[model samples]
Target chain A: MEDRVKRIEKALDHFLPERKGSLSETVTDAMRYSLLNGGKRVRAVLTLAFCELCGGDEDMAMPFACAVEMVHAYSLIHDDLPCMDNDDMRRGKPSNHKFYGENYALLAGDGLLTKAFETALSSEAFRNVGMERAAYAAAVLARCAGEHGMVGGQCIDLATENRTVSLDELCEKDTGKTANLIMAACMMGCIAAGANETQINAAKEYALHIGLAFQIRDDILDVTGDAKELGKNIGVDAQNARCTYVSILGVEKAQALVDEHTEKALHALDAFDADSTFLHEFAEKLATRSK
Target chain B: MEDRVKRIEKALDHFLPERKGSLSETVTDAMRYSLLNGGKRVRAVLTLAFCELCGGDEDMAMPFACAVEMVHAYSLIHDDLPCMDNDDMRRGKPSNHKFYGENYALLAGDGLLTKAFETALSSEAFRNVGMERAAYAAAVLARCAGEHGMVGGQCIDLATENRTVSLDELCEKDTGKTANLIMAACMMGCIAAGANETQINAAKEYALHIGLAFQIRDDILDVTGDAKELGKNIGVDAQNARCTYVSILGVEKAQALVDEHTEKALHALDAFDADSTFLHEFAEKLATRSK
Candidate 1:
């Protein structure tokens, strides 16, 4: 991992203590189990990278970085619920439900989602950013996490289960379930950095493109990567009979779409004149990653 | 219902349009279904009343009111999930899961919760109020709804299922699950109305007492009231072996505690001016109600 990503992971660990000895011990435990589980720290790294691209300090973006991770963690937990994807594994270990049981997984997800907002609102750096932008950031996170974004996408994903999905339907599902929060993370980072509306819009465009590319890459990886490489069970999507970008479009077509999105994402970087190297390279790396 | 409450209900209806005209139609429909299931509208009414108490206009409190109800509605929807309470009914009708299916219910709850923050942050009324108070209200609501408050309480409640609980454990559960949001609602109302900290604290105290009293009353009513009046399967707690104050303290003792809490709630109201008649009476009514 990059030093910046490592720093964010360390900060997340420090900031999210177990809340030990509290009534929420179990919830805190489940949240920590998933959050602390080894991952790429991609969202937080992206958040900090975008903030830095806007000349914002990492310290100022810490809470949002943590919040982004919390949101991602919560989504994974919920996505693994019996009524949802019903997966038993994540990150090459037991999923949250596998460890904590289904109900705990649900509550843990709720706790993390709520905690993300609390963290964002209570952070001194966030407060120093002024309420208007903070509120904007908060709203963006909520929209992305909720029905209009991730939740909405998940709902459609469930609706399409065992059913063949057209390419357009699959794209829409990918946009909502996967792309929305990624886009929100980028936009939120910029908003926290006190970027202007134009800058924020550019960041959002970049996020949307990269977010979709990330999903497409995931679809490709599910078909091509080994179970160990992907950190979880392989061909789970096929086992579940779920449609994906790779399912609708062949692997080659999906790869082409990834290229298109990666280019679009880089185009969005053109609007910014700062140290864009990290963000641009990160977008490329995200789209081209094997896992 | 009071005229103001009716007005708020009407406003809630207008706020959530019932239509399925797009690809994301189901999500929008689920949100409307959960949010539009009419309740007492107590939270919104209190917000408006608090705004009025602080010399603010009803219009100024409208968004905050809707936001409160949305949060409340979302909680109920999720709480009714099969993995949670498995409740089939709420407000004397099929629960969100029962009507919309579990997936839709989950997204509906998520949608309502997220839309709530979005509405609060974007409301013209919130902008009219200073950002400080708006942020304060946002923080309070987030905390109340998160682990330390409602969600935490719920976690305990779930853990304690089918276990015999002592009075203290029951109190802790009720405090986290039921009373916390009530207290938050009152505090948010005061903050929205731009009340001083002293007034906010006083309102919180009143809300805390009333909230506990309300739950105790519920426990009492669960044992004593008819199913028709209660609109739920009363004695279901005994059937499920769920720990409740009534099961722990017995009916008469539970009533006595309710009386005590009612007195404390009334005493808390003494700090407020005598002109806050309806708010004070609402507490009394909540304590003494049969259902």
Candidate 2:
């Protein structure tokens, strides 16, 4: 797992825009700052793992993996803005807006988001995977990250702040806010590997379950986990009065739901003929994570 | 010109995401509100005109044309944020942040930027133009709109606000912030039409000169034009103590520069085999417009 993570990190560094000593160098520096900040890299790892599972070259999947990570990084930057979640810390360090001030941080987020598409579209991987598939993969990333996916989810989350919502509502919010990008990552990997509909659907299904489980686990950790271990302030959701699975269903029920979703995620892997031991362990680890 | 503007307007409306009565409806509405707001569809028109000049079907260029317009709209929304320009009016109406509030305005900007790529990558024109060309066109748009392009230009503008800079520095800033997108529009049109390198370079050169001319004209207008004619406040550069061509070179010299750039822009069109009467007139009109 550490080896895979190191590989993903190296690829992300390689794909980042260079820091030229030009007028716009500050924003580019901010983009690199937030993007290269240490995170789990789960989405990127899933992309590469799923591509290899579908008999595709991991090298071809690298671009998409880095692209997904970029989108995630941008979202984090925006979410931490003063008008959004107003977070001052992320990953045990100052949030982007805190580090670079609001203006450059905002531009940095915009830069990363635009850079994600630029990287994916210009990648040499398209020559190997075919442009049609490459275009489709990029479109999927856009849709998942755009109004109907992550951004939409963020809107809903903001609207529902300070209100206790039902389990179904929480699930709907989590699906958009969290699951959509995970699903995009998995589907893009499958598409890169030339997987047919059945395999693609299976990967998507797997992602949906694990994504939900991951969110629920996050909520649980916010309540019970240590802030140092989590690399961010805990109890933020409760302080903000934000709705979450743990908030709606209680910790025990949330834990049960995570286990259930983990099982479902593993079950979806049955369609793949290749050994998916890594994915199986990955799902369980995410469901039971401390942070 | 009016007929082309109407066509561009309809295409923009058609390409905008539908507003479903979902939790995310407000951001989508914000997107449409800002995007469909009455404004000169200059970039879109440039795209389609160049496509037609390159002997391609205008229908095939519609997607790229609309994509450029989307990027322009998103930039406006972000530029109006309280942290940025902090303007309350745009095109004679309240700015997006004033209309939809700051949070939705930010997400709307993000949604529009993402959707721009989605629209271009998923267009039926890709099938007609070949995936390779389509990908290249999308990459071009991304590059122009990303950190080294529009966003980078914005960063420079923000950093240098309230401070006077050299004419060369100002030119570099405007080229990135204003001319990069215009160049992308012309280049994408040429690419969509499968134009040769010579044709593509010519269109780029034309766009670069006109883009500079357009910015210089804008500075002149801000100083001498009426508010009603401009649809927004005039003398904003003076109000914010921002440095522009007019501030650096005086109005008479700035106007001279605009005329010079306009003539250079027209000269670049000499490379085209097809008649470029519209572009010739477009450059002249832009150089002399009151608003």
Candidate 3:
């Protein structure tokens, strides 16, 4: 797992736009700063692992892995903006807006998002694999990142702030905000590997279950984890009166929910013919993570 | 020309995301409000016109044309943010941030940008034309809109605020902020039509010239045009101490620069075997427009 994570980190560094000593260098600098910040490369690792499980070369999946990470990083930058969550720090470091000011941070987010597509579409691997598959992967990535997916989820989150939301409503928001990208990552990997429709569907199922589990774990941590370990302020959801799994169900119930989802996620991997021991471990670890 | 503009408008309206009765509906609503707002569809028109010039069916290029317009609209929304230009009005209407609030406006911009790629990549026309061409067009569009292109230009623009810059420096900034998208529009049109390398280069040259002319004309309008005529505030460049062609060389010289670039643009159109009367007229009209 550490080896795979290190590989993703290296690929992400390679995929970032190079500084050309131009006036726009600062925005690129900010983009790199936020993207290369030390964070668990969960989505990227899933992409690579799923691709490998589907009998695709890891190199062929590297670009897609990096692309998802770029989208993730860009979302974080925007989420921390003064107009959004206004977070001062992320992952034990200053938030993008705090380090680069609101203006450059905004541009950096925009840059990273745009670069994500560029990286995926321009990759030689796409040509080698198949243009149709590349287009499909790109379409999925864009759709998951756009209005009906991550952005939509964020809109709901902002609107529901300072108010309690029903469990179903929170689930809907989490599916859009969290599960969509994870689903996209898994689907893109299957597509890249030329996996059959059943295999793709199985990957989607796994991703959905794990995505929910991951979010529930986050909620549990927000209530019970230490800020130092989490690399961010804990109890933020409580302070903001934000609707979350723990807020709605208590930490005990949330933990039970995480276990339920993790079990389902592991079961979904049974559809795969290849060894999924790594994924099983990943899901179990996510369910019981301390931070 | 009016017919072409109408076609582009319809295509943009068609391509916009539909609002389901979901919590994210507000962001989609804001995206529609800003995108469908009455404005001259210059970039879209250029895309369709160039496609036709290359002997391609107009319908085949509609998606790409609308995609460029979407990028243009998203840029304006972000540009008007409080952390950026902070303009309260756009095209005689309240800016997106003013109408939707800064947070929604930001998400709307994000949604639009992501949707742009989705529109281009998922179009049936791309499948018909060839996925390779579609991938190439997507790559160009993404690059022209990303950090080294429009975002980079905006970064330079922000960094140079309240200061005078040299004419060369100003041109570099405008090229990224303005010309890059125009170039992408023209190149995309050529790619959609499967034009040869020479034809693509010709379209690029034409776009570069007109792009510079358009920016110069903008500077002239800011100095001499009426706020009501322009549908926004005039003298903004001067007020912000922006380094523009007019600020550096006076209106007369700026007007001359517009004429020079327009002439060169018209000359570049000679490379096309097809009738370029519409594009020729378009260039001349842009050079002398009051708004």
Candidate 4:
């Protein structure tokens, strides 16, 4: 995992736009600052792992994996804006806006988002994936990141802030906000691997279950996880009056839900005859993680 | 031209997402607010006209045209953000941030940017354009809108704010800040029309010339344009302490430059034997128009 994370970091470094010592220097510097800042690189790992498991080479999926990471980085940057999450720190470091001011942070996010597509389309990784399938993957990634995906979910989350919401509503947000991108990562892997419709659907289902579990555990960790391990301030959701799984279901219940999701996610792997060791362990570790 | 503008507007109406009645309503509403606002759909019209002149069907290029417009609109929204341009009005209406607040405006710009790629990818308008060319066009769009293109230009513009800049510096800014996207539209039109390399290059040169002319005219208007005629504030460039062609070259020299670019633009269209009368007329009108 560390090796793969290092590879992703390296690839992102290679693909991300360089600081051109002009106006681009400001935004690109901020983008590189936030993007290269330490994180687990879970989404990129999933993309590469699923692709490899489905008989695709990591080299073929590396750009897609990095693309997803770029999208993820952009979302985190925007989410931490003073107008959004208003977070001052992330991964134990000052957030983009905190370090670079809101203007640079904002353009940094924009630059990263646009750069993700550039990476996906023109990267050497897609050279093996073929243009048609690459286009398919690009469409999928954009849809997942667009108004109907992360942006849509973000709007709903913002609108529902400070309001008592039903579990279904929160779950809907989870599906749109968290699960969609994860599902896109899994689906992109399958697409790159030339997996058929059945395999793609299976991967999508697995991603949904695991994505929800991941979000629930995130809510739980915000309340119970150590700051050193979590690398962020605890109880932020509660402080913001945000709706979350741990707020709706107590820590114990949320943990149970995470377990249920883990079981379902593992079960969705039945369609695959590969070793599945990494994914099985990944699901379990993510579900019950302290961070 | 009015007929084409109406067609472009209709295409945008079809392609711009409808409210999904969820959290999507908030951001989508904001996107719709800024996108559908009245303006001369010049970029979209140019896309359609160039495509048609290259012997492509209008309906086939409609989505691509609308996609460019969406990209243009998103740039405006972000450029108007208080953290960016700090504008209160656009097209005679309150800016996106003023109407929807900064957060929504931010997300709305984001949503529209992502949607531009999505529209380029999945719109039925690409049915006949082939996935390869469509993917190629998508890559072109993303590249033109990225650090080397719109965002990079914007960063440089922002960095130079309240700073004295030379005519060469100002022109370089204009090329990146404005010419790249226009160049993209013309090149995309050629790609859609299946034009060869020579024709594509010619189209690009034409776009670059006209784009410079168009930008110089915009600078002239910023000084001399009436608030009602321009449908926005006047003398904003001088007020912001920013350098512009009008400021660097003076109004008379700027107008001459516009005329110079206009002549070169028309001459570049010599590569096309097709009826380019509309384009020639369009260039002259755009260069000399009051608003």
Highest-scoring model, DockQ:
3
Which of the two candidates, 1 or 3, achieves a greater TM-score against the reference? 3
- TM-score per model over all chains: 0.96, 0.97, 0.98, 0.97
lDDT of each: 0.80, 0.90, 0.89, 0.86
**Clash pairs detected, candidate 2:** none
Minimum summed lDDT over a 10-residue window in model 4 chain A is located at: A17-26
Q: Write the residue-wise lDDT of candidate 3 on A31-124 in tens digits.
A: 9999999789899889888998999988878888888889999999999998999899999999999999999999999999999998888666
Reproduced native contacts, each prediction: 0.69, 0.82, 0.87, 0.81
- Name model 1 segments beyond 4 Å from true: none
Q: After superposition, how far is residue A2 of candidate 2 from its true place, in Å?
A: 1.6
Worst 10 residues of 1 chain A by lDDT: A123-132
Q: What is candidate 1's lDDT per residue for B1-291, written digit by digit as tens?
A: 478887887777666655465556787787887787767777788778777776677766777788789888989999889888888988788998898888778778777877777666655545667666676777788888888888889888877786677788878888889888887777777887778888888877877777788888887777788887777778777777777778777888887888788788777666666377878778778877977
**Relative to the unseen true structure, what is the C-alpha lDDT of residue A191 in candidate 2, on a scale of 0 to 100?**
87
Tell me the lDDT of model 1 at A137: 79
Residue-level error in angstroms, candidate 1, position B120: 1.9
- State the weakest 10-residue window (summed lDDT) of model 3 chain A: A122-131
Residues B158-252, candidate 3, lDDT per residue (tens digit)?
87886778898898899899999999999899999999989888888888889999999998888889999889999898888788999789989
- Residue-by-residue lDDT tens digits, candidate 2, B256-276: 999999999999999998999
The alpha-carbon deviation from the true structure for residue A244 of candidate 3, after best TM-score superposition, in angstroms, is: 1.0
Cα distance off (Å), candidate 1, residue A225: 1.0
